[model samples]
Target chain A: MTARIYITPKPDILDPQGKAVASALHDLGYQEVSEVRIGRFVTMELKGSGSPENRQRIEEMCRRLLANINVETFKIEISET
Target chain B: MTARIYITPKPDILDPQGKAVASALHDLGYQEVSEVRIGRFVTMELKGSGSPENRQRIEEMCRRLLANINVETFKIEISET
Candidate 1:
């Protein structure tokens, strides 16, 4: 089983890195790019099959460590490979 | 237009951060988690509709600044909202 977690800054938070990237894009002639938000993408492989318990455990992991609850939001996607 | 860029470490590269994350998961009782790889997720808002030329420009941005070609690979997804 594989799980992917996508974490992004809260919408109301200021993202300096994203701002820099947006500026760089404009300088690179990608003037169409008006805003940019940078985040984290995490992929993990599990040893066994996927189950509700595993999902819950992964969610706990996200809450405890993978994301900063106050400033970031996360989404999870799971698949069997 | 919104464009999402997912950047990941090259397969052959060593990722200490990922290792630490995997180890942490194990210590946290997520023994099923066997491996973990950490990467970047970037979302950008563009001023116009998605088009071939804009796509090309975004690709160029990825190649030149968004990703470290030698150590990372990036995938882009575009949409109009």
Candidate 2:
């Protein structure tokens, strides 16, 4: 099975990197683009039968290792393909 | 409309941050994890209808602003909500 995890800055937190990217976009003439928040995209391949138990394990993986729960949040998408 | 852009290091690139995270995970007792690669996740709430043209524009945004085409690659997923 494969899983994709998205790790992003907390909504209330300030993101300097995102701010920098937003400014760069403004300078580059992409005026329609208003805001940008930068975060993490993690893809992992796991060897396991795709089951509810495995899904639970993957979520645990995100909470413990893939994301810093203090400053960032994470969402997981899993696929057997 | 909303769009999610996932930006990740090129497969061939060396990711020190990912290495650090992997080591940290090992320390935390997640021995099942063999490798880690850190990347970026961007979620943008976009205005206007979600159309093919709009999607193209969003992808251009990724290529020009959200990602560094040299070292990073991006995939955009758009949804009307």
Write model 2 residue lDDT over A1-81, tens digit each, in one string: 777888899999999988887788778776666677888888776667568988888788788767789999988887886
Native contacts conserved, per model: 0.94, 0.49
**Which stretches of candidate 2 lie above 4 Å from their native place?**
none
TM-score of chain A of each: 0.95, 0.92
Predicted candidate 1 versus true structure: per-residue lDDT over B1-81, tens digit per residue: 899999999989998999999999889887888889999999989887778988888888899999998999999999888
Model 2: per-residue Cα lDDT over B1-65, one tens digit each: 87888888999999899888778777876665567778888877767778888888888888876
Worst 10 residues of 2 chain A by lDDT: A28-37
**Most accurate candidate by lDDT:** 1
Q: Which ten residues in a row have the lowest lDDT in candidate 1 chain A?
A: A25-34
TM-score for each candidate, following the candidate numbering: 0.96, 0.83
DockQ of 2: 0.56
